[model samples]
Target: MTKSDTITWIRLSAVRLPLPVPVSDAKVLTGRQRPMTEVALLFADIATAEGHRGIGLTYSKRAGGPGQFAHARELAPALLGEDPSDIGRIWTKLVWAGASVGRSGLATQAVAAYDIALWDLKARRAGLPLAKLLGAHRDSVRCYNTSGGFLHAPVGELVENASAAVARGIGGVKIKVGHPDPREDLRRLTAVRERLGDGVPLMVDANQQWDRPTARRMGRALEEFGLVWIEEPLDAYDAAGHAELAAALDTPVATGEMLASVAEHRELMRLGAADVLQPDAPRIGGITPFLQLAALADLDHLQLAPHFAMEIHLHLAAAYPAEPWVEHFDWLEPLFEERLSIEDGRMLVPGRPGLGITLSEQAHAWTTEVFEAGVAP
Candidate 1:
């Protein structure tokens, strides 16, 4: 067979690309103005070696590099001669080797992009969508509106945006809260809850902005609203604080986006830091590790609610029983190949191979010549 037809090896590299235009209005905390720097991942296609490719763009609000792109670059050399289809094995090898180096944090984040890209390529080559490859039993996964559109707006505006989401047939909604004043935060929560009504699932995330005592107080105050859960109420690393809050309040505690390693998940579970574990596919090493973490969460009887990147998270959640809600944020759709659709409050998990999502024509053009970042062609 010709080398092109035979399954061979994969090469890895990344593009230091900028968004079409600067997103100056983006947020982190306190409504500060910032621009986003994306570290786009491109895996060489040799086996399913078509023009097929995938992009895993890292969203660093501070326009950060090196640190963001480090994992893809560091792990690429080790992956040069490996089979693109051997994703599970590749994931295991990396985990075992990086065991002492640590699995959560930056190392896993980087590995996640590479593994996701490889999976994308594999799906495209096999002429199958990601959902089908993963043995999808359903065509779509339900999603919650996270607008993530704006966080520092006035109370009325927040309600309007949320109402818009509700009108769109979205069954769930998530809002950001971490204001220093307890009363003011409560008002915001109360306003949102009032707008969404009693039965709707309303969840709030503190972004790890509150301390232990303050978090407990806020959790208690918000309990009357009957929040689905209170998220990242304390520092992501403070297992003790999480445990304290979890034990003190009636509201279910949820956290894990800040955690990058499986060991941390183990500790958090042991401490009862949270009743819900939120794992981001790219944040905690990639699909393989995320799956492992989901398994752990399953064993712990905790619910799984992934942080963001709803497109990819849908598949991961679909594969596991624990994931109940997938955060819906469309900020990165312009950079992707295809947009994952949400119908009747559910997202259609890509039925094609790999992640089931494709690179959109605009995404390809943007990442390729125009974005000044070459994608695998």
Candidate 2:
């Protein structure tokens, strides 16, 4: 006999995790954004009437953290008495509940937390890791370190960071490019490549700062390095521009991390805009929608390299059909009690059930606000 579990309670917390130092990329260098000093995280904890619990999270950089928290607070009650196993159904309902906000961007991001929580709940109930529950293709995924490659670091520091990450068992290193001075960008990459040698899986991210002409020139110039990919060479929305850029360069063009909806990613694919699709699980409305998008990307035979939040992406990447890359940023390590394993250039899928994570005392200490829904003592 089967007993349907009803989601009876939901708790949302807003956290501000401070970075050890200000972070900068081409977005900062180009004067489009300020250096980042902290990240705003929104966490969802869902409890079922049967005493089953699950956790999920989403985050924002520089701004919009509070907005996501607020949205989730308003959206939490909708889950009360609903089947926790009906992830796709609940996701659709949440999207329509905030229909005024449209189906993408902030709305999707907020709903993402709950949607992920449901999947986590489902996996925990089945006593399996999320990747295995999702039918993983591998037990581990290739990894690359991006935190040490921000634009603010000097060339010496960049080389040092790359060297350290490689030695630490990361499969590759991705440095920030798209400097105001193209020559300076070239100079930095030359030094990094010279130090890392040709065998390493090296990559560069423009962070959407390059125009077509600049991207074209840099793409041509970058050919000698044999990079695994060039990320966000143009604005993320410029599918046609990215398609042209992807065609012009032998190196695969990667983008879509900034996109907020399946439609946005579909447009990128319809035009063949990118060779590598870098969707973020939390950013695109959690693993529910991410799996939807992954199916589409796989159909195109495109490469996958989910952006940040390695904790969540490692499981998702492992489940991907094509070998995928998971970006590593240890900034969120303090939030969780469990740590991921990296060995021989890959991140192993944790065998623990669900997300295989529990919030740390530090997470509770950093929590700025809390909201509870449909649960009363």
Candidate 3:
């Protein structure tokens, strides 16, 4: 293809809409009510000579609301006329140029969509699978099922979910703990392990609900369950707390879901605060930054179990040696063109170029209002 055949203008637009997804027992560790909101993004290569297009999403029930639409609009002007082939340079420009507001959260997620689209477009141009382009790896990737279907479930119900996961061939499972009462949490852990038997690798996430003392107490009890790790036991911002917990606990203290910068992760590693790191692909800019973060984790002897977005995380984990958990949640299936393939408890890395997915026709219809509105940020 000639220079004229390449992408000439990138269009970044988004939609803020609610999906009709059922809550499958996922509850806030604090037992607080969940914020009801969902956000998704659509990026177009208006100038693509090959008719290549890609879509991405950033679903949040937290602080960043429909306000992400504003960030997406702000970035469109900057990327509208850039070459899709210049993915690395463009990604750097997007993240660094908006340091004041775009270094984290929705701003970073918006940039991530476009950056990931560029990679998809680039991969399409080269006729290569994303994993192959990223690194040489086995085509199939491992996965751990995170059946968050237990927000209000009794301890028995949670263990039932674990048994169901194992029955379906998954080898690992993640459970949410950190209820206000430490003893009750231990009771739940005991029931889950007893039901799942001794062989399954069980991981627990506190979702940043506990403080140092509470985390230490919970970690001590969890040690008996042989937990893979304890995730976000304390605040995500507390590096010293994590280091303290690591020192006090036998189960590895895991975090990094809320970290938005490479420097932040580097500091966490230097402090020896964690044994496993879980970064979200869309949350921390995009794959480019994720790879840099993964490299940092590898060098520091830390494991990279990314926070959900397992479809995307599968690619990253396949590229690296860190034993990762490809969080198995079905919330996005309503919007994806190709669903992730998991068998025998592992997620297979897609061989398609550029994130290997497109927006489902139904999802595009649902999101039409947000994109067509062209709402000002």
The most accurate candidate by lDDT is 2
- Cα RMSD, each candidate: 4.4, 1.0, 3.5
In candidate 1, how many Å is residue 291 off? 1.2
Candidate 3 wrongly placed segments (more than 4 Å)? 1-6, 9-47, 368-377
Winning model by TM-score? 2
Writing each residue's lDDT as its tens digit, candidate 1 over 1-377 gives: 63432223444334344544333221344454344444354423233334455434333334333454554555555654465667788777766665676665656665776677766666676777665665555666667876532455678978888888878777678877877566667787788888778977888888787777778778878888787888888878999999989999888989988677778888999998888888877777677677778778888888888887776778777776644778887666765567776777777776556665545555545443121122233
TM-score of 3: 0.88
In angstroms, give how far residue 76 of model 3 lies from its true place: 1.0
Relative to the true structure, candidate 3 has a C-alpha RMSD (angstroms) of: 3.5
Q: Give lDDT tens digits, candidate 3, residues 41-89.
A: 4443334544655444554554454566567666666665466677778
| Model 3 weakest lDDT span, ten residues long | 368-377
Over 12-80, each residue of candidate 2 has an lDDT whose tens digit, in order, gives 999999999999999998789999999999999999888899999999999999899999998887899
Clashing residue pairs, backbone N/CA/C < 3 A, model 3? 24-149, 25-149, 25-150, 25-151, 27-151, 120-354, 143-346
Ranking by lDDT: 2, 3, 1
